[model samples]
Target: MMIHKIFPSRKHALHSWNFVMFRFAMLSLLFMMIAAGCSQVERRDDQYSISQEPQRIVPVEMPPSSDIDIAPSESTLSPKKEPETEFGIRLTRADRYSVNSILEKVLEYGITHVQLGGELITTVDDLILNPEKKAFVEAISRRNQSMGIHTYIWSSELNLEGRTFHFNWTAPLVVARQSAYRSVLQAVPEIDGVVLNFENAFLKPWEAVIPAGLPPFSSRERIRFVIDMVRSVVVDEMGKRLLVYAGTGKEEYATWLTEILENYPEEKITVITHASLQGNEFLDVWHPHFRTVGLHRHLLECDLTASAFGGMRFFNCLTDDLYEIWSQSRLHDVKGMIGLVEGEDFSRLATPLQMNLFSLAKMVFQPDIPPDMIWNESIQRVFGLFPASNEGQSLQALLRNSFFWWRRAGMVKGIPLLSYRGDLPEHADLIQPLKLIDSDALHPGIRFLLDELENPRKQTLIDLAQETLETTTWFNRAIRELEHIASSLNPSDYEWLKQRFEQQRLLANVYYYIKQCYWGFRYWEKNKSEEEALILEAHLQRLQQIGEHLEQQINSTDEIFYAKRIRDFVADIRGHFPRVILGWRDRQWNYLSDIRIKQAGPESVELSWTSEQPSISRVFATTGFPIFEITKSAVETPTLEHRVILDGLKRGARYIFKVQCSTEDGKVTNSGEYLFQTMPAPLL
Candidate 1:
């Protein structure tokens, strides 16, 4: 008999709780939370006396108890079969009834590993406090192991004491890791190994973890040191494997990997990474890991969930981009893939995007088959459209255009700037920070476009507007073409796709308007005139209209395809109306941001600041007050970040400087004087 593990959903929670008595529920929950004892469970320990069973939603279609048996013993377990390319799926949800069905269906696609994903259990403390989860995982793990399937858990941190406790990095001793529970491995011993995410958005940097004085470890040293620590518990003592998820950002991941490989030549630990250089967006660039000596330790993953962009609640598709990763994988000596079915917040379990989920899984077994054929087969089965028919081809075009437009929608001038994950902005606050989160500056390319917008040195307004408009236009075109030919397709799928695509297609307008508004604001800000203000407000009003439409859809379907996030994104745009466009118009202005002194020397000082809008800025300084004498301009180039060098200064002298910034459309503002002191003369 096979066991089933399911994620609890909102719909099932109501009935599942009805069966549990209040007293028993509280007692059982306490037992699970204490399964990882506060002081007892340590490195390499697998002691489990926990029988804290929460009320699991029993599968409706599950076979009767009389027909099932316990897991197969080790002696009777099936032999492992090694395929050319091994595959795995990362699952966060386990619905009561259909999870068994979902598992049974995916296993047929040749997955050798089942990663009970990171989102299923987050921090070390989270797992420590939730033993029911570990119990559920262990139950599934035993059955998976009997059939030669490997199980792994991706954990964000190793702090066992909880989110409050920080590791004693001040002491470079192994004793510092004392009292820390290897919670996941200790709680669920049946798992093959554990994964550690060392960087990316979730990391607690040295600034946060370390008190004061101690600087954060370098990327290379941090990874190697942490790997050694984890290896002791996972690999050395427990005799299991260790996988270090070095994180997904392109430069950060490459930097860490480069440092680790260069310093430690024979690192035996496996690294799990993704091919999408940006968040959930796949491009044709070469994967950084493939550039290294040993590709076998690198496991390439692609997010089939599209969690960062949005859930498949909309017509979000990764079919082509995912296939591109498969094509790249064949070129490398890579380890098996681990497909993450859920990310951060969103999932694609029961959605229409399950076709993408199954198709990517089959890639391990049928690497030679094209993604198109698999997609077409899924379309035929679900929509009842024959692969050779005109409606089927039109559907294909719709999917392609849908993905392309979505890809462009999240970007501003080619950088992944705007993102939505379900009902929320992927990042916390989208409108307030003109700069990227945690980043002191925007991408240089985005700055370049800001330059063109403010200065109009290159790419006219018409050209700039065309960037997002083309994508919006073609996506709309594809949707219209499909609607005309899809009369023979299944009504339910048509309704589902219509809801998803209409919202997404509707958002393509928001994308267009976002760029158009940027253009409109720049045109207006150059003059701050009545003519320009009306044009700018009109653009803003267009955005407000779309936001209302999104609210209507969300209200009608109770967020059928999850337009709430996009709605919030449009609201963010409306919010900018007051803070950005209106504020700019109604203020006495100096448009500098992120202003700082780069280098202070006896002979010269290098200063830099980013203008709110692109501009050529000149710095005027004097040893005296009020009157400005000497002047040095930022480089002839105009950009958001501008710089000037105040040279010909005496040692130990104090200089007061002010800036005058000039936009290309002929507007200028004089800044208040700011002061900086030159370094004292060095002794001879």
Candidate 2:
């Protein structure tokens, strides 16, 4: 069947006015599909599947411009100086600025374009459904255009409300999606283009769209079909640029993207990829996709919010890092970069009006300028210039080394504990597993932090402990160093800079204590030494102090909800404390957590644990060795909280065991290997 029905046929008839508009939109899409060379002809797969193989839409020609240019305002301020590269800023949380503040910063930083995300209008669905939001966004778009700055609407594909067009891409869903895209363009006709990042999605449609999966050629073509379907309205009909996110770091993705771009004219489809491989957690080296062939001609997305490193709400300055990103982008295709400025939703990150937003502008213009120099200039702009002294250098070092220190501390053994979403506070289920940082693994979907940490040749627990402590200790020390110089500076500048540095210090310590707390448990599991347990206790106590501090600060939220999320974050971490503390001396935990050796008798060894939620526990044990062999006993646990005793075990025998917990849905996580010894028989 073809796309005869967009929504299930309504028993009630559409209003006469809405019916006319719907008719017009369908007609426009039909015209675009035919013009864009989307073949409606049936394929051989029609006989095999319930639905027909959807005909692919591929753009063959550029159509005329749809939007009329608003005459530039006579008072529009030309940038005092614009950089050669066209720099853009994508505002996730746009409420941070008014129309003039946005334009003033745009002119100040020589920004050419602004990509507006959910902060203003929320989503493309809002534009189609909410008249009030559409009016507000439309007014803003016009205001931006009047100032001679381009504006692009951010669209998350298949992610609109009531339309999660995920893996299943039948003809009806595809056509409905295209119709929705057309409606957005038709409604907000003033915007330059749409920034769609489904390509950057965790489960990218190219790989997941088809269930049994299509061949390479078919997969690429299928994505092209979706692209061209949107382009038919956004580009071919409207003469607008389509900025697609090229986020997959795979060379194959690059190859697919290169082929896709080759099919379209230059500048028709702008491919933006993150400059950081690990999505701006810290220690962000240039992404491989950023250096790829066709992508060089596109833009690099640089995140200034520093979501994982405490965002802009806390001490957030990436002045030096921005220089590196700008340098890499300059070396690549030189289309410039986009900074993700401002707080989004209930995220922990906030884009304070200050915090060196202009440093990015400074670095790109003078790429060779020292990071310290760029930061010093930005600091001078905010507060009066530092006197000829070490005070300036100390301040510079503090900002420059902040990111470096945070990365070393936060990412222990080079693995990040990521939230399900992009470091949003509301999505704080963070005591989860670790993810492989920046590896372009052949396959997608949850790659393990455990798998990487378990590498035999990787850094030992002791080495990680040392490095994490050193980086964090120095960072905290640097925060303290600012006090000595506070007397030399004006009180307000001192307070402002100190607050930023203090936030960094607190976050660094948080990462440090959490890392030590977790790693200490794992380390103690190996030898179960008294000294290690004492150290672990100390780390946990510090975590408790930090959590208390965070609670106090969040209590003073000052009406900024972003500041309040620290409560959720710290609470979540605190929630994990007692569970991980299960093995410490004697603690009864009724939750799912790390496997612990509860009791060992002369003839029996006991293994105990809890789960993330209610779960069934299973234990596999091997005797007198670290490896589990074919003859190893497999014990099944009946409930979420469990203590399984392996009876009739030889006395003084060392048992190697792994406990895995399965949720009701059958999702399982096998925690660390534990060592246990049965009591010696009669002290022989």
Candidate 3:
């Protein structure tokens, strides 16, 4: 029966096979098309394509309201009501696709306000030339307004004709910028306000130093210009409500701010001031820029919320202290805080930014939220949970400890390091021994020349290296601990954890190289050893690789607030790397030795030390510690120390002491532990 059925020719069979193949291919094509359609459907939910028909731009002309309408509410700026906290974020770029995600985030965190970044527009050129940006601005404004989130345009000194107007108010560009701003306001009246980033130009690091034969720009003139702009645009034109970021300035500026507020009515203005908590003058000597009155004091004493202005809204700038800033702001009667985020990505934001925003929301609105719960949620979101184990817990602890130490290190020098651009002639004061060595720039936290330090024997360099070593150790330990936890995680989770910890590992690697670089350079300079030079060259190359890798990470992440700083750190490493130059001043290095306790008793003890090569007469001591034990903390000498006779000691108790010294050449010294046993008191 089979032979009879197969009597047809082979050609017939080939035709049948081709037909089947064609049908199968068609079916597969259809399935792929359907799958792609489904994928597009998902993206549609979160993205608004630019190709879609644009919204109608209806620019509003702000009309005068009746006195009753403008009248301040009885509550004024009080934050005790239903909307206790007004969370705002600064968006660096406004794109149509991001609108949905932003709105979703706004809904997620109850964000009440947003500051549209100035990067979108600078001069009249941007306004006239960039039509797409205009459309984008209008769309973003309308979208935000629809969601009941107020949006404001933010810009630093007006940029016009390629000239920046930050501190140079007298430039002709100021007048031109005023008209340009008006056009922008008319173009997007849906925007709630305009934040004038008016910081004193003279206060900026580059501007702070006056070059030879060039007089500094008149700060008074800059102030006058700011006042005029505020009066005209914010008060007279009434285009948008005024918001000002009066940065850390002197008492005169604060007084002037008070005077400026006297003229403007409340409810029409908000002042966002900088919070100096992390840079508290006592703890952070690195940040002399924040030496002025902090927001905590300004809010209370500046009379910003007084009845005269009908209680103006105040805000805190979380410059460094991420989560703690919210509580501090509320304590100071601040209505809300603006997360000073810098970066291009909001979706899947950087780990730090996500943590900061979540913490802010929890503190501001969800006070009952447990911190551990948040931590667990964050871990799950970033890296799916691994099975509970001792190693997992230990890894978590190590990661947390690493985070704390990293934050502490960054926070300690956040502001001062901010101002450290390249070692320009104007910034000679900041680079010690080469120029103005006695300047305040030589803070312990901001040792700019740490890696290139000339004196390897100097105790300051050793102490600095020790801190780097400790932090690096913590980072390394965290990376090792993560390995055990990784085994329990899925492939994706493991990869995510590795990527995150990669940052820490690289940081530790860089710090490790920093110490090596210092010692290598020191050896080369001391011995002119060809081997040491080669070592230094190799280390420098490796350091460069690590720095470039770190910079790439910084570039990839949308952690805007920290991106500049992280890059700056990389640049600093490069700058301090070994480079030969003529006339590089080698200041005499000073150190302390022969530290001896001349007298020891129950009631008092005499401590003495001599500077081998005197640089300064200062000496520092640590409080009583166990002999041969690591001192947890030490206090700087309140005044010069020749011989200190410490009084009121307890009898029959063992005490340990250590001494440190500073020099005019900006070098520091640390003497090892000096232990003494107090004799028992005589029978009274």
Candidate 4:
């Protein structure tokens, strides 16, 4: 009250006010210093944040360099490796009577590995045993370059009177046979091993009938005897390991192998058996360590057979059925063994030849390759015997003629398509008139061939075409006869028959036409005749349209129709596309995707998805423990969403996440595989 009255001057009053302000400022500064000190103390008590602050303001501890480890760079890490290569074979055999011709043909076809049958070598053996003929035997063996012995004894009939018992698996007969074969092997040092067909001993009635008093041997005993003989030859005399392979069936012989192998460690010997029996009841004891012998027919029957044969087949002039079987069994690791059989019934052989030729044609022409099963089955049906018929001779002639034509067609068409030997060997050219009228025609054999030919591979086209064409020709003849037979019968008796015949005819024709178009296109392309190639192209389009229509009608409810349609469409385009252009797309589409993840925090997660397509988006997660919700709020941009996802999750918990993205068309554009993690829980 007195200060206002007593204030001497304005200046003096202002100075007094300034002093009061200065004191208040000092007090505020002191309070701020105390609060900052308290904050530092609190931070120290928290432990987590104390060391994270700058040391200039407050003292902070540093972790040891060893305690704070850095991850190794990617360059320091090892890379994933590829599988190692496995040694495999491409085997052939010298058929009896055709040894020289067949061997030459095999060599012509670039076949190196071969098995020389006993009959083929018998003549040579006779010469070798006889001093005068010894040089001839040596010369023949050297000339032929026999890879291995075909078989020591094909039948137990060697025990018959006409033939002195050359070999028996059991008793003294076994020893005697081994000694004989051993001598043969020793004489012919180039020979690899023997191929025995124990089934021959039991297949025929003459072979099956046994003498009343002779000591009986069980199937097991026979197998043991065979094993013993093999051991004697391989282990005793050769001083080296040798293959012991035999032809067997799904019947008793397959069953007998188990007991035989059980007595001896299978690893000690290589045993080759038919794939037909691999999965039968005897499979439990089936030893896989040894080689598995798969005939062409068995190879074509089942995919599993490929596994048995280490992925290969014996490509010989076996029955169509056998060839079909081999084709069906896709033994990828095994190469084909191609050879001509001596004294083979061409009618029987013709089926496989035609089928193989057709397959080759198909391979050359079609964009979509077929599998071996279809070809195998087709060949089997074509070559397999029908019920005894009065038309047997004529049928045989027709089949032979058809086979010849098919072979010719294959040579003409396949050579150009495959760019194979432009010279067109005379042997292939000689068989042209028998070319199947329509390689696509459906018959029992064609159907089988088609089934086998459904999945084509690089090595399969030539053989598949040859098989398919042969099957188509045989099927065409069969369908024609059925049509005629139906025409002769009463309406009621033959109505179904006629319908069936028509249906089969349509299928057969479709197959044959397809083949023809394929080969024609191939031939035209090879000759650089654009117009002819275009004609064949148009023909193929027509056939495909028909096939597509039929397929759609038959498979109305098919879930895979779109896939099949796309496949066929691509195939059609590819069939017309030149090989040079085709290889480009093949390389482009072979890219693979890889994913990696890193953790940022116990509760927070980060992920990245990378690929050619940047538009991909979508993520799926599955955790052993319940997850509330995955949020995309962390990512600000849509395009970069694929880079990472911040998942707020529980600490110390395990989790898995899967991701996928869709195209605007609703098709799956991309997918991210499963990921696992757990968030860290905060400490007290």
Candidate 5:
């Protein structure tokens, strides 16, 4: 039956506001059908599932060895790091200028160390010429001093310019580069100390400036350079102190650190490492490779004693896993611990500000509370799945998993259509501006054609959307559970919970729109009929309307923190539907099929494909691995026959290849990943 005839009773109502509700009802029915037929989507350990239980609170044990010869508090500064005052936070130069904000956080959290990251200079001239920069440094220094917080300047070996530096690593340097070390020290005399943030260079492959196919400078050279740099700073420049915060798991680097401590006076240097202590107390640890107990033993083996190693500190980075932070602080002879407070670390999570606030309050001020006791209290702080209202045996497990899922879908990372890179396609119909669809424009002729096309992959997308909707539905249920039991929360706690609740609601809306768009795409792709276009167009309008209403409601919300995120979410959602429509109209939808190897020669292969629509095809090939792992990016060619000759394959070796097609209009599609083996070497 034609769509118009199928909904003949509501044909006249299409122009009314009720049209949106009608479309939503139809879309929901479609989702119900697909969801009921689709098998359950596999759930990650962190995802919401009916069978999973909340994580349990596990007590952290002290290190095996007790002989970490920590020094007594020497002066008002206390050389040995402790909780509250010992916690440090690193900020960008932008954050450093936000003095009031920094001070507020410091005062609230009792933070004693503030590390400032900014432009790295190599020469005394570079430092002296930038008076504004020097003034900013001096200002931070004085402010931190008044607040009883020590401020350190943070710099990495691989400077921003993508050049190898002598002071950075053990690379051979001209006299000019040799003087860079003293220049940095002399330029920042007002600062308490400087932190050399040396880590494995392999982690930032993009930042490497070495020759093609060559790796970045190794951490071993960096460690050696640091040791010599510290010696020169103290001996030649008579630099009083320096801080080294290295997050290296390599044993060689740890051994090198041991040598630095044994050689240098403990009072002159402070070594800080990433503590990554957050989440569950049982499984989580500061170091990625081992537990806190194992880390302690490693340090002991390295002879990182209070008297031997001097000032040693550990910090939580990337996550605000406060439960373990409390435990780490109580470790014997451990100098100090720092916590991440700004940028990606904070922006990535829902309720980050509040979580950090609570973490700081408990860790700093409530030092008397035992770490394990605090862990127990914190486990119950966040909402759990299946409260008294739902079936649940484990509160901790629920809290842990909920936080995990919340992080996954909490924010709009990238807008689908508005965030396209490079130039947009010039398809006339695809690029047309969005407008409300007229019922008369519906064409049933293309619907029949669409019904004839077979696309299992398209059906798979619908299945995934169904699964995602199920996940979001459960998330919404958990949010409602929190809302129900939040009466006992204080005003501030309630506000935080409400903010999270609002974000969860926004996330659900995003998932719903995504499912709707997927269905619309399938509908349009199948038929491309006037009726199908109108149907898709109406769905687009419905999505925009939802975004508008959501924005209006959120804007009406008084005094909301992170309000901009919700506003951005609304914009992304509204902008996404039109992009998807353009993709369909422009034939950017990837449907490369009938791929087969025409020739598999000794060193090369010829491949061909037929797609649903004509497109500019590009092929990418890699050997024995994913194409993405290769250094050479994908090559593009507008294929007339949808064929390409791939050269440089080794005989008897396996290769993976994939194709991508984009229309002249802005739409794009990717082919399924393919793999094949070349014939063996020919007998000589």
Candidate 6:
């Protein structure tokens, strides 16, 4: 090679040609080698011929016309379905009320669930090993019953040592409390869960004064400790899921508590809220699994007091707050718990007053009534207590004075009954069936008040009271008529009418819609700044699209069937819309991912998504598809994942999906989708 190079360097023509030839030879060798490799691959491929086996096309056999039963061939007769009447009472342990008697009364009223009072479990020892109490609990359970243990350990009077007003957030004490509570629960197999009186224990400590010596724990820390305690009891000791109910007053505390519970399984923990404190903020925190308590005493006393005063001022009070809370809870599809403070005398005016109050409380926590109608009906019911007679002037004066004080307290309006502007015709209509009476029938002192109003000196009070009474009467009549119509119609017809009523009612109150939107905006603005506003705007646009599509479908339907269909649709829409909207918002906000839609069957469709954090799913129906089924499955992966499946979809239909997600930090996200269609019918 050296000699050859030297020859080339010498600029010999033969040497240059030889060098070129050598390069060409090497290139040819490379190409040949590559070609050989390619040939071997081709040969291997040729040897491995995948046989395209003849496909056995099995012809689908359509049933013969005689055998092809489009409709169920057995009979067109409908099943003899039993009418369902659900009734439950809030069973509490008051000094005057016997637990056994109350239990019997509950059976009489067909009440199913009871919230056992903390007083019932007077001491830790009582909670753990009281034989009589244990026997009672066993009896209750044996009768296919459920009991929510009032409390494990709570302070009525917070002191420095035992039963302190303030909680000790130190790890040792917290852990000890958890262990102690767990031991109690384990010892008593009948106790369902613990109801921690957070509000009574913390915010409104029973101690008359706060002690200066001890350092107070931050609210967040307290909430965390409580949550940790619950986890220790339920997850560690019980070896099964248990409920930790923080009976809270403030929405902020609920938010904090929920944040801590985000680490626990949704099925394992639940938040129980008093009816009167429900609001959008609270709803945002608890969502689907929030449990509401309808306490009878608050409903009658506080709510009635506010309504009698006519300012709707009571709206801020716990009693008045429950109406809206119940309505909103139902609207949000949250589970509701009704507590009837029964065995108290309703025959006494005070008795009725108490009864009404508690009834109102229970009503507010129900996942039933429309929200718009909630306050109006509640107010009307309260005002129904006034009498028609001019006698008992003193009583009337007392009532008016009480009403006046309520108004001054910012619990109600000072306007005369008729002068107040809050009554809705539809709400009034709904109330008629409950047989609500006018002030004359309701208030023993009303006659005297009426007389005083008609009297020359009492004209002012009379004029206002009369107007309010008249308006209430009219409202009551209208509601009665609606009820009559509801009763007379066929089941399908009644459903349709209900839907129509809801639609008209909601539409009529555009202000409420605007208010809700504004609230949503405010929430976003506070939490997400300008970015949230943009996201919300996008959501509104999506909602508009869905609304338009729904409108078109609704409008095109037949008029005769419209009322029933529309009513059912509206009810379903109300039930399902929030969930879908919230869910979609969550997805868009990066709270979760992997949204999947699965077709379970002809009658069912399931929408599922994944979140690394703990979350909840709520399903709603908008139209003909009236039912849904939710299921969760575990998937085996390097990192274990959960797959949630929703089934029971209607074929040839469109649906909307709403989802909401929250994290342990109290960060909430929502998402929604509209006009999702089920898969087409399978080809025969």
Each candidate structure's TM-score, on Cα atoms with residue i matched to residue i, is 0.64, 0.61, 0.54, 0.30, 0.44, 0.33
Worst 10 residues of 3 by lDDT: 1-10
Looking at model 5, residue 213 earns an lDDT score of 52
Q: Could you give candidate 6's per-residue lDDT for residues 1-684 as a string of tens digits?
A: 001110010011223545544544443343344323332222121110111111111222222223211122121111112112222334333322244444434433334345544434322323322344444443443332232112122222111122333355442333334444554455544444444444433223333232478766665665555555555555455543333445534456656665555554454444454442212233433343353321110111122323332222112123324443454555544344444342333332222234334445456434344332433343334333223322222222222223222222211012123212222212211223223344544333334433333232212322222222322232233334445544433455344334433332322222122222333443553355454445444444444444455456655232223334333433432342332343233112223445455677777665665654564444433442112233233232312123444465566455545344445454444433223556545647
**Tens-place lDDT digits, model 4, residues 1-684:** 001111011111122545444533443343234323323222221111111111122222222222212222211111112112111122222222323333334332233334333332322223222333233233334443333222221212122111122234443434434444555455545343444444433222123334456766555665565556656655566653344443434334544654455566543454444334122112222224223332111111112112121111112122232333333333333223222222222332232333443443233223134333334444345534332443333333333233222222223222212111111112212224224334553234434433333333322333333333443444566557645544333454245333433443343344444444444544554466555445455555555666566666663222133225334643664556553311111101111134445677767677665433334465545443123245343233334235665656776544555444433443333231233435445557
Provide backbone clash counts, one per model.
3, 4, 5, 87, 16, 62
Could you tell me how far off, in angstroms, the CA of residue 550 lies in candidate 3 after the best superposition? 11
What's the CA error at residue 325 for candidate 1, in Å? 1.8
Per-residue lDDT of candidate 1, residues 1-684 (tens digit): 012333222121222334333423443343344433554533111211121123232222322322222274442222233455668777765432333444555455667877766435543433444455555566667766766677776665433211222244333222223113244555556677767665422333322344356655554555566667667666666656667665555466566666666555344567666666243233222254455624436677767767667655567666666766776676676666767764222232325447666677666567777666887886676567787888888786677546656766665544455654533343323343454444333445455555554454223343434445545655666667767975875666567677676666666666656655655555555656675465556666666666666567555553433355445544554555543354222222335554566445568888877676678888888775434578887866667888788778877555667666777886665553444656656757
Error of 5 at 189 (Å): 3.4
Answer with 2 or 3, whichever has the higher TM-score: 2
Superposed model 3: Cα runs more than 4 Å off: 1-84, 94-100, 122-125, 158-177, 199-225, 248-268, 275-320, 343-350, 367-373, 380-399, 405-465, 487-490, 518-684
Return whichever of 5 and 6 wins on lDDT: 5
TM-score of 3: 0.54
Runs off by more than 4 Å, candidate 5: 1-85, 93-98, 104-110, 118-129, 160-184, 187-190, 198-219, 234-236, 239-241, 245-320, 324-335, 343-402, 408-467, 474-500, 512-684
lDDT of 1: 0.55
For candidate 2, which ten residues in a row score worst on lDDT?
Answer: 45-54
Best by lDDT: 1
Question: Candidate 5 at residue 439, lDDT?
Answer: 27
Question: How well does candidate 5 score on lDDT at residue 302?
Answer: 14
lDDT of 2 at 84: 51
* TM-score (C-alpha, index-matched) for candidate 2: 0.61
Better of 2 and 4 by lDDT: 2
Q: How far is candidate 6 from the true structure (C-alpha RMSD, Å)?
A: 36.4
**Weakest ten-residue segment in model 6 by summed lDDT:** 1-10
- Candidate 2 lDDT over 296-396, as tens digits, reads 35776766777655564455567656765665566566666777765333221123334445777766666666665666665565545472468766766
Query: Model 6 compared with the native: what TM-score?
Result: 0.33
| Candidate 3 accuracy as lDDT | 0.45
Report RMSD (Å) for each prediction in the order shown.
15.9, 17.7, 20.1, 41.1, 25.4, 36.4
Whole-model lDDT values for every prediction: 0.55, 0.53, 0.45, 0.36, 0.42, 0.36
Q: Weakest 10 consecutive residues, lDDT, candidate 4?
A: 1-10
